[model samples]
Target chain A: MAVEVVYRSSRDLERLFMDKAEADRHDKMLELAEALASALQNAAPTLSEKQADDLGIFMARHRELFARAFKNNPEALAELPALEKN
Target chain B: MAVEVVYRSSRDLERLFMDKAEADRHDKMLELAEALASALQNAAPTLSEKQADDLGIFMARHRELFARAFKNNPEALAELPALEKN
Candidate 1:
């Protein structure tokens, strides 16, 4: 077998990246997601950990639109860009 | 005073906007800020209300950078654009 090198995101060892930058990015995203989840749980104790984690990941994935909403263009929230199917 | 028609953001009665769109945007930003403040307070009870509000506004204003960080580019947090002086 040929030797292959791949960078694994520390956040999720299951996934591997061809480039270090990509792995770093993924790790960063996971960190932000955790922060968001923690915040959500803190503010609303009624929410389960799973709910908070799911919401956190969702927000992190669509954060650009969220940024626009926070940036004084709430209408941007309604305008979601088309996503590519894997 | 000249007869000037201005729009006011319901979020903050003290501020007035020259355009309706601008007012709407400001209102939206305030709404987001409030949500963020609530989250901050919820997740971290040690933070005072004032501190939460201040941080919320700061995050809301610089949401683009925050979004980038959430989108797997945490380095974006270090790349802040210069703000215009009023």
Candidate 2:
């Protein structure tokens, strides 16, 4: 028998993950991001100026380094260093 | 001690975000994306031309609508129309 449960948007997928990656799943996220990035390049033919700007900004934030933060635990942002020293 | 299982790099956090979002965690993705974008703009002060170009491209793919595709289920990509006709 299968049981279905409702999930709320507020607490949805947003709650999981960490700074470098999840306790268990980090590689998959990298693969998916790469695939999704490829898809958008091929599928999206046109976008307005602002739309393009949003795209640029969003992509930069999903850095392999910082994304790890989101990967380990989504709430890890609080503990991540505010600045990455070069 | 918490039992720690090894996660394969092939299946990391990268696999999670769909084109638009995820099922239960769609809003979280959006919120976090926004926060992440802001953090990068403030934190990273240097980048080469290629790095900046990559940023522009990645941000475009995370459309609010397409992200919904991810939120519903991560595997929905095969079904996502190769081209979303305007």
Best by TM-score: 1
Which residues of candidate 2, in runs, are more than 4 Å off?
Answer: A1-23, A45-86, B1-65
lDDT of 1 at B83: 33
Backbone clash pairs for candidate 1 read A42-B42, A42-B43, A43-B42
Worst 10 residues of 2 chain B by lDDT: B6-15
Over B1-86, each residue of candidate 2 has an lDDT whose tens digit, in order, gives 98654322221344433343242354454445554444444444443344333432333234333343333323434545566443
DockQ of each: 0.14, 0.06
Supply the TM-score of chain A against the true chain A for every candidate structure.
0.84, 0.27
Candidate 2 structure quality by residue, lDDT tens digits, A35-75:
44444444444433433334333332344434443443334
Q: Worst lDDT window (10 residues) for model 1 chain A?
A: A77-86
lDDT scores for all predictions? 0.65, 0.41
**Superposition error at A44 for model 2 (Å):** 2.8
